[model samples]
Target: MKNKEKIGFMCAYTPLALIDAAGYAPYRILPSEACEDRAGHLLHDNLCPNIKKILDRALAGDVPDLAGVVFVNSCDAMRRLADAWQHVRKDDRIIWIDLPSSIDAMAHAYVQGQVEQMGRTLLSWSGSPMDPMAVEKSITSFNRICAHLSELAPAFASGAIPGGYAAMQALYNKASTRDFTTTLEEIEPMPGKTPAPKHDAVPVYLFGNVLPDPKAFDMFESCGAMIADADFCTGSRLFSPVTGGQKDVYSRLTSHLMTKPQCARSFDPALPGEIAKTTLSRARAVNAAGVIGHVIKFCDPYLERLPGIREHFKKNNMPLLILEGDCTLRSMGQQRTRIEAFIEMLM
Candidate 1:
C-alpha cells in the first residue's frame, strides 16, 4: 500500500472512489491542529479556520508526499484555500472542480462531467488504462464503507457503541486517510453490545462545520457530556452512502454527494429548514437533552444559517448552545467551561 502514491481531496463532496480507481490512495485533507502563521501570510486570517489550518499543513510540509490534489470548490473559503495552496506548494498537479451549488438534474450532469474529467486526469497520471469495469468495482468497495458508516452512526449516537462518539471519531479519522478495503475489514468486527452509559453524563447532539480533532470528543466526555449524535464535516458526513441509482457511476456518485446530509454550504429551496429539521430529528432519535452547534469562526456558510437554526430549535422546545472557534484544540479548550456549564444546565 505504501508503494502507491497518494492524491489528496479537500472536500467530502469529492468522490474518493474515482481517485481510487485511478490507482492512487485517496487522501482526504481534513483540517488538522496546526500553527497557521505560515498560511496566514498567504491567505486571509478572517477566512474559515478549516482552510487556514489545512493550508498550514501544506506550508509546513506536514502532509504525505501527495502525487496531486483534487480540489472541489464547495464554498468561497474552499476556493480561496485552493488558490492559496498553489502559492504555498508549487504543484502543477492540482485539479480544481467547481462544485455546483444547487442540486438538480442539470447540476448533477455538470458535476458528473467535471468528475468524469477528474477521473480521466487521475487515470492519466496513474498511467492506468481507462477501465469502466475497474471503476465500478472500486466504487462498490468504497460504497461498503459508506453503508458501514451509516450503521455505525446510529449505534454510536445511541450509546450502543462502547466508546460512544469519540470512538466513532477515531474510526472516522482512519477512514479519512487509510485505504477503504482495509478500513472496512478493520471495522467489520468493531460493533458489539452497548456499553454502560457514562454515569450521570448529559447526552448532547453536536453539529458543526468542522471538528477534525477527535480529542474534542474526549473533551466533551470530560466536561460531563456524552455525544448522543453528531453531524460535522469531519464526522458522520464523511462517508454518506451513495444513494442507489441506475445511471452511470459518476452520475450516481454526483447525485448522492449533491443530495446527502451536507453542511450549510448547499441547500434545497423546498426544504428551507432542512439542516435544523434534520438535526432535530436525529437528536430526538437518540433522545438527546440538547444540541451543541460549534461553528468555525468566519465560516460564512454555517454562520449565515445559525440564527435560523437556533430559532428552529427554540420553537421545537430543544435547548441549543452555540459556540464558535478557530478549529483548533485551543478553541476546544476555551469551550470547556461553556460546555461544562451547558451540561450542567441539561442535567
Candidate 2:
C-alpha cells in the first residue's frame, strides 16, 4: 500500500479515521486569502467567504497532491463548492457525503451508512481492502491527539502558551496533516520556561464561521482581550473527543459525530436552543466576560442564528459582538476599530 497518498476534506463531518484507515494522510482544506476575485467570478459574491476562499485555492491548484477530495453536505454553500470543484478539477476524484441535518436514531443510521460507504470508497481509491484493525487504530490515534489538545487547553486559556492565536494555528496545522505523536512533540512547551502570568484582559469566547487567519485572534488580543475559547468548525469543534468505545468502526465514528460541537449546519428540531446552550456552556467554562461572533459575509445559517444568540446573551447580560468579514487578514484588519471598541466595552 502506498502510504504517501493524501486525501483532502473540507468539513468536520468528514471522518478522518476512515481517511487514515485507508492509508492516506488526511488534509483539511482551510480558507486562504488567495484568488478571492477569481473565485468571486466563478461563485456568486453573495456566497460565504469561507467557501469562496477554498474554491479560490482549488482553482489556483494551490492544494497538495491528493488521491481524492471528500465534500460533505453540511450546508448549501459547501454542496455548491463540491459542484464547482467538479467542473474545475475534472481529473481529481471527488466524493460527496450527504450529512444528515438533524441528530436522531434515523439520522445516526444514515450518517453511519454514509461513513461506511466512504470507507469503502477510500479502500477502492487506495487499492486496499477494508481493515477494521486499521480503522480502530486510527480512531485511537485521533483520540490521543484530542487528549493532548485537552491538556493544552488550560494553558492556552490562561495566556501561558504564548498566545491563543498561535496555539489555534498549531492545532489546525497539526490536525490537518501530522499524526498525534508528531503533533505532541512539535507543540510541547520548551524546558525551563515558566507559564506566562495571567492578566486581567477581558476574557472572550470566539464563535462563528471559519477564522483561517491567526491574525484575527491577534487583533482580538491587541484590542485588550484574550481568546479564552473558540467555537469554530476549524478550531475547538474539530478537536472534540470520540467516546463510547464502540467496537464497530462505523458505529464509533457515528457516535463521536453525534456528540461533537453543534455547527450551524447541524440542526435538531428537538433541541432548538442547543447551539446557544453549547455556546453559553463553553463561555461559562472559561469564565468569559464577553462573546465575539466573527462570521463571513452572506453566511445564511449563522445570520439566521444570530437573533437567538443575541437574545441569549442579552438575557444573561453578556456582551456579544457580531462582526462580518470576507475571510482575509485585510478584512479582519478593517474590523480592528470595531473589535477594539467591543473589548473596551467589555473592560
What TM-score, to 2 decimals, does candidate 2 have?
Answer: 0.93
Tell me model 2's lDDT, rounded to 2 decimals. 0.79
Weakest 10 consecutive residues of candidate 1 by summed lDDT = 190-199
Clashing pairs in 1: none
TM-score of each: 0.93, 0.93
Global CA lDDT of candidate 1, please?
Answer: 0.81
Candidate 2 Cα deviation (angstroms), residue 239: 1.5
Give per-residue CA lDDT, model 1, range 87-182, as digits (tens). 877864888777776688888788888988988899889899998787788788887887777677657745677665677787888887867777
- What overall lDDT goes with each candidate model? 0.81, 0.79
Q: CA shift at 299, candidate 2, in angstroms?
A: 1.1
| Candidate 2 Cα outliers beyond 4 Å, as residue runs | 1-3, 179-181, 188-196
lDDT of 2 by residue, 1-347 (tens): 33467788888777787888888888888877765457778778889888888898888888888899999888889878888888888888987777777888888899888889899999998888888998988888777667666666556656676666656555665666644445556555532134646588888988987886777777788888877778777777787777786789889899888878778878788889677777877898988999999888888888888889889888888888898988777988888899889889888
| Model 1 segments more than 4 A misplaced | 153-164, 192-199
Screening candidate 2 with a backbone cut-off below 3 angstroms (N, C-alpha, C), the clashing residue pairs are: none
- CA error at residue 46 for candidate 1, angstroms: 0.6
